[model samples]
Every structure is written in structure tokens, then in C-alpha cells.
Target: MPSEQVLLKPRLAPMIWLTETSAPVCVEISDGLRRTLFRRMSSLISGSLVGLIIIAILLYRNPIPAFFAWAAVDTILVLFRFAVIGRLMRILRDPSLRRPRDTLVVDAFIAGSVLWCAQIGVGAFLCMSLGDPVLAVFGTMLSTGIVGAMCARNPGSPRMVKLQMVLIIVPYAAGAAMGPEPWLWPIVLIAPLYLWGTISINRELHIDYLKMLMAQQESSHLALHCSLTGLPNRSSFKARLKAAERNASVLFLDLDGFKAVNDQHGHPAGDALLTAVGERIRGCVPDPADVARLGGDEFAILVHADDERTIPAIATRLIAEVARPYALPTGLVVRVGLSIGIATRRDADNDPMLLLPEADQALYEAKRAGKGTYRWFQPANDADLSSQVRELRDMLPKAQTVREHGFEAGLSVTRA
Candidate 1:
């Protein structure tokens, strides 16, 4: 015969033991709360599974009330699982979303809301269905306020959680003492969950901020340093140019035979020659001046000066500096010339990049006139570029005069 004593009493004591022993243990590192929350979720699922097995075992004897309670909790567990799994997948899809502030807000909102709903809904269901009015009210008030407190004390703000818990639980506990029938329990539970959701949304705004900082740092380094020569690049040159005074002059120098060096000695020897040339140029520029490798085989120098005398002297010094022969790795003594273009800050804007093009044009003229020389963008040079149309008009008449002179010379030679 089955004992009525065993059937009448639920295994409430054993269930309590299972819940307590299996409760999550998370070591709170500075970021320990996240791990704790994760472990708590794991514990909840595992403990719920155990509870379900126990429910199945007890179903053979008067399973009505037990089945209803287990099914209600189980359904709530499924909903919580769905919410958590969705969030996990989203985080995996976007790794940036899992960073501290972003992750805390997101997980706290979705997971906190699901848990809050489960706690209250399950509590209310057990209360109404079991007909234990005292137990029902106790479960409802405790679970509802507990969820509120959990939301308040979540990852985003542990202090807020304490305040919220006190405000929420005090009223519920007071009402519980007077049969604990608080009309406001349901509304209080919703407030914290929704508030946390808003906090999570705010966290998303700062995700791009971290990304911007990383990009800015990378760009700053790239702009200031040469990619190949490991020297100050064009951006550094421009900054130095701006700091230069009015009396400072810019000297742009290019290796005259660099292309031939590259063509004859292969690129490896060319690169070595360029590096040696850069060191030699730096040696020539004054201590107060800035030296930079502006681009391939091109260097710019900005020297502070008292008068125009300094610019020509610096240009001469650069020519003498680069005129020395370079000893190749194969021990060949090869000589290369320098074509420098000189410009004063008074004559041009102190923009290294912009001044580079004008200086390059002057350097081209120097090379055309002869190798191993310097040129300046004087008023006459500007006039020469402006006189292209007049030069074209003079050319045909000059050629006709030369042809007539040649014919007259031929007739005189025949008479002789």
C-alpha cells in the first residue's frame, strides 16, 4: 500500500537543497561580473534540467499540481534560453559588440529582462494554481522584488541595483507582512528591466569611438614617418616648414644620376645609394634646420637665416656635400651630382608639399642647363615660362633668316 504521508508532502526540502548547492559561483575579478553572470545562466539551466528530472520521477503519484508548477518554470526557462542564445549569436557576429561597456549593457538588458519575467510570472503562476494563499503571496512578492533588485544591481551599475532593491523590496516586504498583496509589484519589476535596456542602447553609441581612436593613431604614425627609409616623411616636413621663420629658406635637392644608378646597379644598389645620400644631406643642413626625405630620391631642408646670403651658401654646401663619390658594396667608387632648387619663404608659401612642385620645376631647369648645379625660381625664370607664345612667333622668322644666310654662303663658295 502506498503511504499517504509520502504522497501528501511535496519534496520541497530536497528541491531547496538542489537549488542552494547548485547556485552559481563566480569569482569577481574587475571584469568578474560578466563571468559571474555567464556562470549564473549556466547554473540556472543545469539546475532547471535537474528539477525537470525530479518532477518526472514524482509524476506517478498525484502529479497534477507538481506537473503544473514544473511546466510553468520549464516554459519560462525556454524563453530565457531563446533570449540568451540570440544575444550570444549577435555578439559573435560582431566582436566589437562584446567589448566591456557594450557587452555589459546588452547582456544585462536582454538577459536581465528574461530572468525578471521568469521570476515574477513563475511566482504568480505557482501562487494562483496551488491555492496556498500565504505561499502564493510570499512567492509573488519575493520573486517580483528580487527581479527588480537584480536589474538594479546588474553589470552596468551595482550601486543602482542596491538602491533599486531597497526601494522595491521595502514596499513589497511591508505589503507582504500585511498579507503581502501589493498592487504595484508588477509595474516595479518592469521599470528596472526597461531602464537597463535604455542603458544598453546608450552603450552602442560609443562603439565607434574606440574604433576612431585606433584609426587616428595609425594615421598619425603613417603620416609622420617614411614607409621605406624609416625617416621623417612629407607630413613631418610640412609641419617643420610651418614653424620656419620668414628669413628661413627652403632647399630642395635631388640626386642627379639616381635614375641611371637605379638602371645600372639594380634597385638594391640604388636604395643603398639613396640612404647614403640622405645621411650626407642631413650632414650638410644646419643644426637649426629640419631635414626630411620628402619622397623618392628627393630631400627638403629648411634653415633659419638672417638674410638672402644664407640660402646661396646652404645650396653651395649641399652641392659640395653630394659631389663626393659613393663607395658601392662591390667597392666601386661612383660619383653622382646634385641638382638643388632654392626658394625663400618670402618668395613662396612655407608649404613643403606645394613648394616641392615649384622647386621640382626649378630642379628640372637646372638639369636641362647642366647636371651638378642649383636653380632658383627668380622673376626671369617666371618670365621665360610666360614668353612661350613670343618665342614661338620669333622662331619661324629666325629659321628663314638662317636658311637665306646658308644659301648666300654657298654662292660665295662657288665663286671662289
Candidate 2:
């Protein structure tokens, strides 16, 4: 199978087992989630800064020293978060520098520590009865939202999610456990349930995400490729032509006896022949050169070349290769001839539309001259020949009915 086909195949989840050898799909998902983490972290820091200011104001008169200490700790954490965000922005610019798991771990630890410290200092200042429950409830809700967002953003790594959740929940749980009041002990029980629900939701979201990725891959592949031959279709080929730099060459090919093959053997046999021809053309081209099926028996190849001389050499090879016999599934061998036309960016002034029409005209000339040959596009003579051929085709009878006849020593054929 071709590498393109392999790329279209659905990939397994890389997070099932954490390893350094991750797939490209997983890496892409991780990078996207890492960027999302930066946005979430920014929101979190803003909220934290506001909460710290409000808490400092509330405790300004009664616990002046404690306010200063808490404010100092929060300022340091905020600065560190800003630094991490700066590093994350650098990672966004250069994806190779991404270390999302480590960054997330650091974030989780700092956030958890800040929450724990705030609960301890504020709970003591306001008396345990009111402060402990308020802090516990708020911390639980905040942790749930943070952990849920992280999971939704980066569901490819369950281990990362687990580590973050543990760091986020443990400090708050520990603060509640170590509280001076006995009534606050029940708050610790909520942590495990919250963790379970978050994990379950993460697992489901990850599964759905993988399904979506697979569907998208399949759709994109189908849109750009020929379903019968597994080659790039006409639209893909034209897109490639438009993207090519100067001095690029295009070969337009039409099978000479393809209609006869379908008439003699069957449509299935014709399909098999086309598939084999597509593969053979693909084999003849070098890396970066593209082969595409332009509907029916017409095909196109785009190749990069430094000069005009390279075009004929490549076209010659294609002509020889495409004339080879194809083995059909019904234990019969069939032969087909290719008529190829060459066009280059130099000839078409780098216009894809003009380049294709030029190649089409050349192809018409090649067919007019004889089968199993190639021709370079010449706008002067070939354009008139192409127009005449189109007129002849239009004047031909639309339908023809043939009668069965006995085998004869000689056969006669005529154009419709």
C-alpha cells in the first residue's frame, strides 16, 4: 500500500500507554490542547489576582501581617505563572519546544499550594465555622471546572489529567482534613467522587474526539483522491499545478484503446487496468512528482524540472511504462497504449489554466499522429488541430448499434 493510504487509515490512541514514540496525530492534538491551556491559565491567573485583592481588603484591619504574607505568596505565584505563560507562548511559536505535561504539572502544583495556603490563612483569620466550609465549597467547584477543562482540552493523555487532578484536589482535601473543627472532616469525601466523575467524563470525551478525527481524515482523503485507482483526482492535480513553482512540467495522458478494453472484456477489467496503469505511472515518477486521474482514461502528472530537456526524458519513460501489458483477474492479459502531451510553466507563463489547455492540445496532436507516443505542446499548429477534433467529435453520431457476426479472416474499423 502507498504511504498516502497509510496516512488515511485511522490511528490508535497514543495515550493508552504513555511513551515517547507518539504518533503525529497525537502530537497535533497535544499541541492544540497546550495552546488552549495557555488561555485557561490566563483566565485562572486573572481570577486568582482578583480573589487575592478581595481577601486582602477583607482582612486589612484584623490580620494585617497575615494579609501581607498571603499577598506576598500570591504575588510570587502569579509571577511564576506569567513566566510559564511566556514559555508556553514560545512553545506556540515553535512546536518542537513543547513540554506540556511538565508545564501542566507545575501549574497544578502551584495552584494547589495557593489554594491550600489561602484556606489555611483565611480560615484561621475568619474563625473555622464560616471560613472552612466556604473555602472548601469554592475550592471544590473551582477544581472541578479546572480539571474538567484540562481533560476536555487534552484528553489524549490520561496520565497528565490524573496527575493534574491529584495535584489540584489534594491540597484542598488536606486543608479540610487538617482543619481545627471536627465538622469540616466530611468535605474530604467529596474529592474522590469528583475525581471519579471527571475521569469518566474525560474518557468518554476522548473516545468521541478520536472518532471525530477518524471521520475527518476519511472525508478529506475521499475528497481529494480517486476512489477507483487511489490516485489524486483532477481537482487535486489542478491544485498542485497552481502551487508549482516556475520550470515545472505537466504531462497530460489519454489511453488510446481503453474504450476497446471495456467493450471487449468488461468494466471491471477496465477498472483493474486503470488501477494498474495509475500504479505504474506513480512508480515512474520521483519523489514530489504527483500523478492524478483526470476522469475516465485521462491522467496528469506534475514534475519539477530545471529545463525543457527534462520534460521529454520523463515523458518518454512514462510512454514506455504505460504501454506494458496488464494482468487482469480473469486470467487474461490486456495491452493499452498511452498518448501523452507535455507542457511547462515556461510555455504557459506560469498560468495553470493555460498550461492544461496547452497540454490538452498536444495530447490531441499525439492522438492524431498515432498511438503509443508523446508530443510537446505547440500552441500555433496544435490549437487548430484540437479545435478540428472537437468539431469532428460533435458531428459524430451519438449512438451506434452493432450486429453479431461470425469470425472472419480480416477485420475492418472506422471512426464514428
Candidate 3:
């Protein structure tokens, strides 16, 4: 079918000459480099054609016919080259084209034919033995060097590079071998050496590209994951929450006595405890749920659950699991409890910011009700606090800023 599709398909045998092993090349990287090389080569070819036209005018006694013919052919090729470059630029912007490789191959073959025609003209214009044979050797060397440089930039697939190099070089070599001069036959012998050198460069570049890809992958993984607990960090968690289903739920967990652990022991012990808690939370959650450490002693989980009962059940399990004792590196057994607040899409309007606040309010309620427990958000309970302040205002009409005063007084009363 399409050349892009063909390139993507698994190769029957992708032979690397040094290793004698088969491996699939990365299609995206290869195609991108090919487009870049095509642009460079096309510009170079157009410039060379203009130079050839100038030389033909100076060398030939009857140059008018040759000029017009060269002008016609060069104009067509230049227009076609621009069209291909435009298509490639569009592909770079939006990758929807079906057969980029096929387009490139067609252009390459046309370029090869042009080179063959130029070589034949040069051999006919001058004596075949004197000027033609020397031109043939020089042309072959220049073509080989250009192709090798282009191939170095795109060493993803050995087979594809080999094919493109063959298309460009074989025609020129054939022209040299079939020339009228018997001495020029030996020029074709250098073709194998040129191919071997190009292949060697391509193999080395391919190995380097593979190493770069692996390093990039490792860096990406480290960026998205927490260094301490190896869980998804806050940034990754929020991204997942944004893309999560509308029916998903979030559980916000804060350790009850984590600060005391840090005070009694040290920050290292606190970190160890947090790591253990993260592991327990991971074990308790199902595959569809993602656990993230949202800095310090706070953590979050995004659970895929459309059912009303699923949130509470998961939250309760998490609280129990997190409350379990953790054995530290120093052989010290420490206990900590979890205060969890759960908010579902039905309660939070499917907004993470709103969902988080709902969970936070519920978490405050859980801490007020006494830690080591979980709570679901209740809008009525929120309104009841304001109603209680209003009742205090009615009882004492002098209380103007009752909302702030009532909250402070409530905290004092709870402490007492």
C-alpha cells in the first residue's frame, strides 16, 4: 500500500552487516531525517545544474539548443523539487501524508537519471579516453560523498539507506563502465569501496541514535516519577486527573502524626515512613487507581469508579492499610494513622480544583471528628456551620464578624 505504511510494517529480515542480526528501525526518526536530507540535496542539485548550464555555454560552439534543453529540464526538476519540499514541510507540521517514502524514492530516481544524462553528455562532448574517464571518476566520487553525508544524518534503517545509496550510485557507475573508452572500465571498480564506506558510517550512526533514545527515555521517566517513593508526582497526578473519566473519584490522605515522627526521630525517619505508607497505599488500590505523593505527608489517589459505594470502600481500606505500623531501617517500629477525605464527581462538578477543596473540607471534618478515619464531603455540614454562626449572631447582635470569631472560638472549644 502506502510507503509510510510499508515502512511501519515489520520487516521480514533487517540485516545489520556488523552484527548479522535483525531489528526493526524507528520509522519516525528515519522519516524526519530523510526529509531534512532531501531538502539539502535538492538545493545542492539545483545549484549544480545552474553551474553545468554555465559551463555548457562556455565550452560548446553551438550552445543555444543545449541551453534551452537544459533550461527546460532544470525548470521542471526545480519545480518538482519545490513541490516535494512543500509536501515534506506540510508533513512536518501535520503528519497525515500516506506515502512520503514513495515520493522521496521517485525524486531520488529522477536525480539519478539526470546524473546519468549529464555523464553521457560530457563523454560525447570530449574525447572518451581523455576527458570522459576523468569526469566519470570525479562524478562518482562526488555523488558517493554527498549520499554518504545524507545517510549519516539518517541511520535508523540500514536497508533503507542501502536502497537509496544504490539508486543514486549504480546508474553513474553503469554509465562509466559502458562508455566508449576502454580505460574508463576500471572506474567502476571503486563503486564497491564507496558503498562499503557508506554502510559502515550508517551502522555507527545507528548505534549512537539508539543510545540517545534510551537516555531520553530514562530522563522522561525520572521527570514524571517521585525520587523518594517512586510514585507518580503531583504534576503527573494532576495530568491523569485532567484526563480521567467524569465518574472518577479522588481520595486526599494526610498522615495523622507524621509531624510528630519527624520531631521525635529525624527527617530521614519521616521520609522512610512516607515511603512505606506509599507502598501500602499502592498495594491497597486496584489497577485503575493511580497513587501520587503530593509533597510532604500528603498523598492523593485517582480511582475510576462510577458507583457511589466504591469511593468509601476504597478510602476505608486505604486508611486501615496506612495506619499499620512501619519498620524503619534502624529497627524502630513506628505507628501512624491516615485521615482521608473522599470526593466524587457527583459532589465536585468534575473539576479537580473544586474536587480537591471538597476533599480538604471533608479531611478537616475527619480531623475534627478525631483522626484515623475517612469522611465524604457534605455540603449540608458546610452550611450548618454558617447557620450556627447566624444563631450566635442572633443571640449576640453585637457580634459583627461572627464567621471568623465563631471559627476561632470553635477551635478553642475543641482543644479544651
Output the better candidate (1/3) by TM-score: 3
Off by over 4 Å in 3: 1-146, 162-193, 196-216, 347-350, 380-416
Question: Model 1, range 284-363, lDDT digits (tens) per residue?
Answer: 77787888888888888777787778778778888998989999786666778899887666744555345556676778
**In angstroms, how far off is 388's CA in candidate 2?**
12
Error of 1 at 306 (Å): 2.2
Model 1: residues >4 Å from true position, as ranges? 1-219, 242-244, 329-333, 347-354, 381-386, 392-416
State each model's CA lDDT, in order.
0.58, 0.66, 0.65
The total of clashing pairs for model 2 equals 0
Using alpha carbons, what is the TM-score of model 1? 0.40
Best candidate per TM-score, number?
Answer: 2
TM-score of each: 0.40, 0.69, 0.60
- The residue ranges of model 2 lying beyond 4 angstroms of the native Cα positions read 1-131, 153-159, 347-349, 381-416
- For candidate 3, the per-residue lDDT at 144 reads 57
